[model samples]
Target: MALCPISLSLPTLQYFYSEMRGVDQENEVNRILGAFKLNPYEQLGLRFDCDASALRRQYRRSSLMVHPDKCPHPRAKDAFEILGAALKHLEDPERKSNLDNALSFAKEELLKDWRKATKHDAGVRLAASLDARGMEGVEAAHVATPAFAEAWKARSREVLGRAEWRRRRMSKRIKEEEERGREEHRLEKQLNKNIVEHEKAWEKGRTERVGTWRDFVAKKAKKSKGGPVGGIKPPKRLRALLRCYQQLSKARLSLLVTATASAGYVAGSREQIDWVGLGWTTLGTFMAASCANTLNQVYEISNDALMKRTAARPLPSGRLSRPHALAFAAIAGVGGIWILAGKTNALAAELGAANIALYAGVYTPLKVLSVANTWVGAVVGAVPPLMGWAAAAGSLDLGALILALGVYFWQMPHFMALAWLWRADYAAGGYRMLSLVDPAGLRTARVAFRNSCYLFPLGLAAAWLGVTSPYFAYESGIVTGGLMLCAAKFVSSRSTANARLLLYSSLVYLPCFMLAFLAHRKPNDVDDRLELVMGHLRSLGLFRSGVDREDEGEEREEDQGRVAAGTSGSDGAQSIAPTPGASRPLPPLSPPILTGDFWAGPMVGGLPPRGAKS
Candidate 1:
């Protein structure tokens, strides 16, 4: 048949054309949202029980693929609009419930049909034929038609298809999540690298500026040398003074001294702590350390000038005169000892004085004479804790000795590695360090390893002495084992790399050990004794109970007045108040006197008698 061309421009034809386009668009929307082709579960790429967050995540991911801006396909805009509408439909309670009910009804219908088909006469005949294996009977009864065969086949396909679909969905989701995590990790690493580079650049610029300034000042000093003033005219008076103080005090080392002192105070104080006394002890230790350091600089001025490491020190650099250094040392030394003796105790003061003498008098001179100076320096390092202990306890005890020994053992590995690192400097300065004298480094490595081994027992000793809990022993053991491993490595290789490793380990080990010790510090024998005495006093009405103080305040005043009157007499014995009309007089009472120093004195099962010496 011959066909005529239809004009789409006509009103009736245009209307028909628009209607066709609308129908086509509706079909595309249905295909994209899977309204008829897929279940709600498959549409959202999730199981029925998926949570809201998972639903949102999957919906957003699908939307991204269909987004008009990203896809720019003719179908994508329709797909995305339809996906948004479907998400809204699923999100609504009534619409979602209706969809779920319809799905469930369909499944029930399928299952009912499957169940009914199994019970039909045709199924019975089929089963009988298959069982008998009679080809003639099977062919007559339609042997290919088994019981619920189509339903079972359809159900199997559904089961396998659902599982495969979910498997693919989950595998793809996992891969995408992992990729996201890796990208985030890469970005984080890049950010950290940028920060580190910034810090490095800042440090480099600062170091260059400092070097340039130093060179400028040095050149100026050299130019001034030929003038009336000497070659090393000091900088501005205040600047020179500050530099001298920093060099003379050896401020970097003072931190270690202070930390050890604080640790010792914590270990030694059993009953109670006197914060004021601890402050005094720390200040005294720092002052004494500063004084000793000043004396050491004075003694090694020439040697220091020879070594690159020590060339910029106060005396060697001529920033301060010898007389000024001596004056600072004398003042600091005397002031430190006085603070200890007056504020703390005689023993602490004695230890501080001894440390100063040992470090300057013995360690300093012996550095030139013998390699044994390192041992003396270790002794000096050990005494600060003893000073702290004596400051708090007013006596040296087993715990104090153990702490001192720990410090002593710790310094051997610490200094041996340091000596190895700086052996050339020591040789240039004519100082006889073990690393410089023992050319093979065998003895130095052995000593370091041996001392590290000693720390194992040292940590255990703190626990055994009841200064710390048993956990400290385990913690300290692990850290000490690490140090020992480093020491052994240095011994085997005798290389600078191994030596640096040992140095780093020792530095890490000391603070960790100190922290463990502090964490595990327990109440010791003194605390028990003090508690006992306080309980006895409370029972005897000599001390007030802490509870119900508002009610007992008047009674406490009356008791204090009575005790005061009883002690007013010249004789040591005072009469106790007797009951009214009692025939027998109360026995004479000898009450003990309470003083500020009483708690620090010896315990006697109770408070000591009045007038008894501590």
Candidate 2:
């Protein structure tokens, strides 16, 4: 990733045609020139007078070239990176020499590749030069041009190809040998089967003889014996989901579109997930959301109990066991992928897994550890829509990213106001938010105002790029920006009243913006924003809007009841009504539970919530 420019900032004759990938342009060219190795303008391929005019002229051309994104060659890209890093280093006068030193090192490496290539060519030409030396003399025998270098490279290629072939063949032989050993072991097991069978037969005969002798003896000696041993039956909970939920955070689950929901409008109004293509993305989103919500419970259950607003939650209320909570998480996490795999494509499944991992693995823990978690959570929240986009498009869509980023950036103002309102509770609960940082709400208010202000530029880009319609642009600008301004001027700067207004505005802004974005019915627009939204809605059926348990319980119960009644053919079988939170009543008491030594199946049913990595 280091892109310090050296002499070979441009494609060095060495790796230019062979290795250049992201580093192929002036973007890198200018970057390399500025950051990597520049003692003076003259040194960086410039002829500037020691004046501002010449320096500005050079800066313009340089800037155009090393724009990073503009680069066409792999080396150019590398150079651009180097240039940027170097610039950052040079920005501090104290660090300029350090950057220069690093650039020098990078340039050396680039030159090394180039010179070695040239040297190899020179060595190969020694033979031809010798032949010429015999025919004409030292003067006529010399080869100075790039032709000699090509000859050397050709020979090198031929030699390397042979070596690669030999290596591959050796690798194959080694693998085959290992496979043969495994096969022999399998054959050995087959051969031992007969011996084991003979031993079983012998044991059976011996047991029969012993029983007969013992019975004969016991007829005269024994009178009575104890009947049976029994123990109280333990109450059963759904183990699979529990186990899955426990193990869920690490497993590959399907896409759950739950993250965007908490985001309120953003979740709803954002483009649709292609149910057919990106269902797993929805699964991931759900896993992330579920994980975030759950982790909040895990870390703040005690704190939540102290708060009147949160005391009714499963954990705080003691309605849900921690193990059960863990298990539920596991189930939801892995089940995400399981459901998605069957319903959508492979990519969706992977995205779901990734989302769970990020949310559960990274974001969750961060809540207990640092304030940065909110930002990280925001990032996790944004990924679901992207996943939705990818699922529908079968590729990455910029529109999805634009929408996601708009939401991500918007979180600052959106959450700051919330943080301010709940600062006291958050501090009491040990939750870090902007309000916690600034108890008076000054800093939190400012951040909300600032982020709301940024929505204009971000929203404008989305509008101009056709990610959404002009309607969204105007609406979002008025809603987000206006609210933020109000909070800053009236609420943020004054007592908490206006701050509350700002927070309310933010809550309103998010959902309203998303709704407006969704409402944009631009006939001429090429993006399938509406189509994707409709598709996901169709897949989710009528309940897409409300995934809350209260809303879903009845529907789930009905479906399970229908399936159970149809399947329960025997009248004598005992059954329990739906377990708490389960779709239906527990299965009849006859079936054996899959657990301990008797339990055998896949370790997990589906993908778990994504763990955080980046």
Which candidate leads in TM-score?
1
Tens digits of lDDT, candidate 1, 11-55: 788889867755654554455665433345555545443577988
Q: Write the per-residue lDDT of candidate 2 for residues 493-608, one digit (tens) a residue.
A: 64667766766676677667666765662322234553344333334432122122223446557868866875685875555445554433222221112211122122234322
Candidate 1: residue 526 lDDT (0-100): 57
Error of 1 at 421 (Å): 0.9
Query: Could you tell me the lDDT of residue 89 within candidate 1?
Result: 77
Worst 10 residues of 1 by lDDT: 583-592
Q: Give the TM-score comparing model 1 with the true structure, all chains together.
A: 0.49
Top candidate (lDDT)? 1
TM-score for each predicted model, relative to the true structure: 0.49, 0.40
lDDT of each: 0.74, 0.53
